[model samples]
Target: MRNLQGWEIFVLLAVVVLLFGAKRLPDTARGLGRSLRIFKAETKGLREDDAKDATKDTTVTTAAAEPVVVEPRPIESGVAQAPAAGAHAVHRDAADR
Candidate 1:
């Protein structure tokens, strides 16, 4: 719980300048700023996407809670019913081949 004094700030800046020369400091700061901005934007987008997905899930759950009624199809006697579209059917009769 200690606040940095002016001397500490000056010393930290001096060390940073020594580590990465004065010429490269501006470029480094700019790159750091850009990286932080990009990270913030990506995190914001992810939060928004999560919020949208949560809403969609809630809506889907509410809709699913309602009962659905399905009508039964009539079948004809003595007739082989064709399978529905996109369904695989196996023929049991060898004579029909």
Candidate 2:
């Protein structure tokens, strides 16, 4: 659409003034400006945070990290193996009552 002519702009302003009244116009504009300012600041902060994360993801660690290896113990037949450290042993007799 083409830009509004002078009279069209005047008419739009008149309509807004009539709808909201003269007294409320400044307050409404101020509130709208504050909202836009806050929105802009938050978006900027998010962009900065994303940039930081991108940098963090690109950096290489100097020291080589070694993978941990765990060996499993062989299970013996016909013997009740005691529970490993920090293991909770459940008694079936208590649950049956």
Candidate 3:
């Protein structure tokens, strides 16, 4: 078991070569190569998918900034503050046009 002579290895090779002929060896190698390529491509695709999922779209908000609030005034207050309120009638041209 420790030391294997050259003749022993030659005998093993001869037996394997006979069991699987030389003509069929190339086909088997090609099939093995194609399988490995497909496996690598699938692994790469899964890695890209994982990366896309890792960098997501939802915004990340820190609690440091204070929120800004906007308030809407009543309709009567807006009409009273308007400069042209007395000069122009409300919705007068809209009905004529």
Q: Write the number of the candidate with greater TM-score, choosing between 1 and 3.
A: 1
lDDT of 3 by residue, 1-97 (tens): 4888999999987887898898887898899999999999999999999999889876877554433444444558445564433443334343353
Give the top-scoring candidate (lDDT).
2
> What residue runs in model 3 are displaced by over 4 Å at the alpha carbon?
1-13, 58-97
Ordered by lDDT, highest first, the candidates read 2, 1, 3
Query: What overall lDDT, based on C-alpha atoms, would model 1 receive against the true structure?
Result: 0.78
* Model 2 weakest 10-residue run by lDDT: 88-97
lDDT of 2 by residue, 1-97 (tens): 8998999999999999999999999999999999999999999999999998987867666754444444445668977777566454334453354
| RMSD values, in order shown | 14.7, 15.1, 20.9
Q: Which regions of candidate 2 are displaced past 4 Å?
A: 58-97
State in Å the error of residue 35, model 2. 0.4
Clashing pairs in 1: none
Q: In candidate 1, which residue ranges exceed 4 Å CA deviation?
A: 57-97
Clash pairs (backbone) in predicted model 2 = none
Best by TM-score: 2
Provide the global lDDT of candidate 2 against the true structure.
Answer: 0.81
Against the true structure, candidate 1 reaches a TM-score of 0.58
